[model samples]
Target: MKSAFAAALAGAALVLAGPALAADPTGLWQTSTRSGQVEITKCGPDLCGRLVSSEGLKADPALKDVNNANPRLRDRALKGLTILTGFSGGPDAWTGGSIYNAEDGKTYSGTLTLDGTDTLKVKGCVIVPLCKTQTWTRLR
Candidate 1:
């Protein structure tokens, strides 16, 4: 009876911990700004995101990375850029990443977390507690 009860308790614990353990931030997500979509994938043990598509580029086929700070990279295309990198964390939240904003050509400290099954809260901070967050939706 003791062994059976212990097995049942372990099973219950697994079931209860399932949701918190299942935060898979992989696949493509549409940014809250509606400017583009990012494909988040596992980069070894960490997570990384790349800009897969952009509305501005879609609107104009001849679009270039004219806003980049680097003059040499100004002629590069923005569609396939890896804007987010170096993220590391668990299923609940990922931190220690940088998200590059092409508009201003600046990279900010980034943290990513799931806000349910379909929404992701992507926070970019200039400093701790001084940040801006955008809710990104999972793409089908």
Candidate 2:
């Protein structure tokens, strides 16, 4: 009876923990600004995201990276721009990444925390104390 009860308890625990343990960040997500969608995928051992669509893209089909710091890259299109790069961590959280903001023409050190299965907390900082956080919702 004791062994049977213990087995059942373990099974229950596993089922309860399943979703939290299986938080997969690879998917389409809407930016917090509601201005664009990013498709996140596995890149090497890290995760990265690319801009698949945006309000700006809809207005101008041939939108370029006009604000990019690199003058040579100014001609690159924003349709498939790599905005998130080199994020490495776990099933629910990630760090050691760089987030590029075309609006400001800057890249910041970034960290991501997957909140539940649908919400993601994205943070970027120029320095430790100077950080901004945004909530991104899963679109797929």
Candidate 3:
């Protein structure tokens, strides 16, 4: 009877610990180009990343999104821009999201994959033939 109870407890422990042991990509990450840092976090039931800092932002604290196609949004600041939006899934991969590029003032369908413990693969696509992938490293 004791052995059966021990087995059940062990099974329960494994079930409870499964999600925590999964690959998690939530943290501050440095871009492959070494131009900016994005901080990923939970947004409602999904994930989102914001541009916390960038080389341009560091150079001129008052940097604006001048290249934005929308003239109204051109004056918006880039420092707190929501670059990654409404990403779903986790552990190893995340998809069904959009990535905003301030440089071109464009948004692309994107995915975030946890490549390793300290590496993340960010992919953005306008279409299958027009996809771009960048490897970002964890900063914290």
Candidate 4:
């Protein structure tokens, strides 16, 4: 009877500690420039991110997607834009993604790496060695 109780206790502990052990990037994160916050969520077998909120949009209600390369989409609202897509990898490292730069209206190869419990490193590469990285802080 004592062994059974101990086993149940162990199982309960595992259940409680599982998330803490795994590196999960799915959460609201503030961009390094503090211009916007991106919400990362699981999309099928991969991960995707969207611009949920932006300081610029808040300050100017008339802001639109003027920087989009496609002229038709330029009139669309900047909110809820899918800026990151096709990321596929483990919790600690994600690759093979495309990051859309709304400011420049360009896309680049993207990689995401979890730095710690509250920080994420987002890198966009024009080429393998030529990359720009930004540190994002988890909001929740």
Which of the predicted structures, 1 or 4, would earn the higher TM-score when compared with the native? 4
Instruction: Find the 10 residues in a row with the least total lDDT in model 2.
Output: 16-25
- Tell me the TM-score of each prediction against the true structure: 0.81, 0.86, 0.84, 0.86
What's the true lDDT of residue 83 in model 2? 98
Among all candidates shown, the one with the greatest TM-score? 2
lDDT by residue for model 3 (1-140), tens = 99999999999999888766547788999998747999998999999999998889899878899988788999998988899998998778999999999999989999999876788999999997799999999998
lDDT by residue (1-140, candidate 4, tens digit) is 99999999999999988766658999999998846899999889899999888778788756688988888988887688889999998758999999998888888999999987788999999998999999999998
Clashing pairs in 3: none
Instruction: Give the 10-residue window scoring lowest on summed lDDT in candidate 4.
Output: 54-63
Q: Model 3 off-target regions past 4 Å?
A: 1-22
Please write out the lDDT profile of model 2 over residues 1-140, one tens digit for every residue. Answer: 99999999999999988886558899999997847899999999999999999898989979999999999999999999999999999878999999999898799999989988889999999999999999999999
Clash count for each candidate, listed in order shown: 0, 0, 0, 0
Candidate lDDT values, in order: 0.86, 0.92, 0.90, 0.89
> What ranges in model 2 sit over 4 Å off?
1-17, 20-22
Give the C-alpha miss distance for residue 109 in model 3, angstroms. Answer: 0.4
**Model 1: lDDT of residue 44:** 86
Please rank every candidate by TM-score, starting with the best: 2, 4, 3, 1
Residues 24-129, candidate 1: write the lDDT tens digits: 8888999978468999998888888888887787887566778888889888877778888989986778999999898888789999989776788999998989
Best by lDDT: 2
